[model samples]
Target: MELLDLLLHPVRLRIVNAMFGGRIRTTTDLCRRLPDVPKTTVYRHVGLLADAGILEVADERRVHGAVERHYRLSRERARIDAEAAASMTLDDHRHGFAAAMAALLAEFNGYLDREGADPTADMVSYRQFPIWLDAQEQAEAVAALTPLLRGLAEKKPRPGRRQLLLSTILFPMGEVEEGE
Candidate 1:
């Protein structure tokens, strides 16, 4: 399957998110994290991701006569690159956006459901800022943020560090009307 088709499913998106930030997780770990999804379904989707090269086996071990595989996200394969994005139709963008929103909602709900959940304590912020930028400025802005985000992604887990989800969406709202 194409990368867009493979990554746009709600379950698969969640799986990808779960595997983000240099984390290596097993099928059991994924199943536990996504209890709403059936164990069989999680395993099946993980298989599909692995088959599609979006996931790789980081390690494997035998446990009670069963081989437990640890999977990690192949960031290169999980991306919707410029060429693929350029080829996506309007409906594809709509479906992709819907799937992404669904995944975000699920993750937010899961976080809220956890014990001792405190959005304020956790420094949770979901604010939207409207900025006016010309095409060149917009490109420059993205160029600036890309490396900072990548640096954060490259960081390994350490004590006293929390794994935080950062989602970014950038799109123009169109030019101002003449009257306005």
Candidate 2:
């Protein structure tokens, strides 16, 4: 399957997101974390991801006479490169974006459903900002954000640290109508 096709599915997308931060996770860990997803479904999709090289087996061990594998996202393969992005049709972009949004919504809903959840204490945030920028400014803005994002992504999990989802969508809204 195409990289985008494999990464864009709701289940697979969630799996990839779950494995972000370079953390290795076993099928059992995934099943427990994503209780809404059936165990069989998680196993099936995980196998497909591993077969496609999107996920790599980080470790394996024998558990109850069966081989249990721990996997981590292959960051390089998990992304849609510029070449692949350029080749995608408008329909593909639409479907992929919709699937991503749906996954984000599901995650947010799950967060809300958890007991003892405190959006304020947890630092949950959902906000939008309007900005005016020309092409050069836009490029500069992206350059500025890239390193900060990269640093955050590379930080290893530590004691007393919690994982936070960081979703960003940046696109031109459209040409300003007449004078707005």
Which candidate comes out best when scored by TM-score?
Answer: 2
TM-score of each: 0.93, 0.94
- Candidate 1 wrong stretches, greater than 4 Å: none
Alpha carbon lDDT at 160, candidate 2: 84
The Cα error of candidate 1 at residue 56, in Å, is 0.9
Index of the highest-lDDT prediction: 1
**Clash count in backbone of candidate 2:** 0
Task: Report RMSD (Å) for each prediction in the order shown.
Answer: 1.5, 1.3
Model 1 lDDT at residue 178: 84
Candidate 1 lDDT over residue span 1-180, tens digit each = 788999999999999989888889999999999888899999999999999989999999999999999999999999899999999999999999999999888888889999999999999989999898877999999999999999988887789988788989888788777865
Per-model lDDT = 0.92, 0.89
TM-score of structure candidate 1: 0.93
Cα lDDT, model 2, residue 111: 91
Write down the lDDT that model 1 would get: 0.92
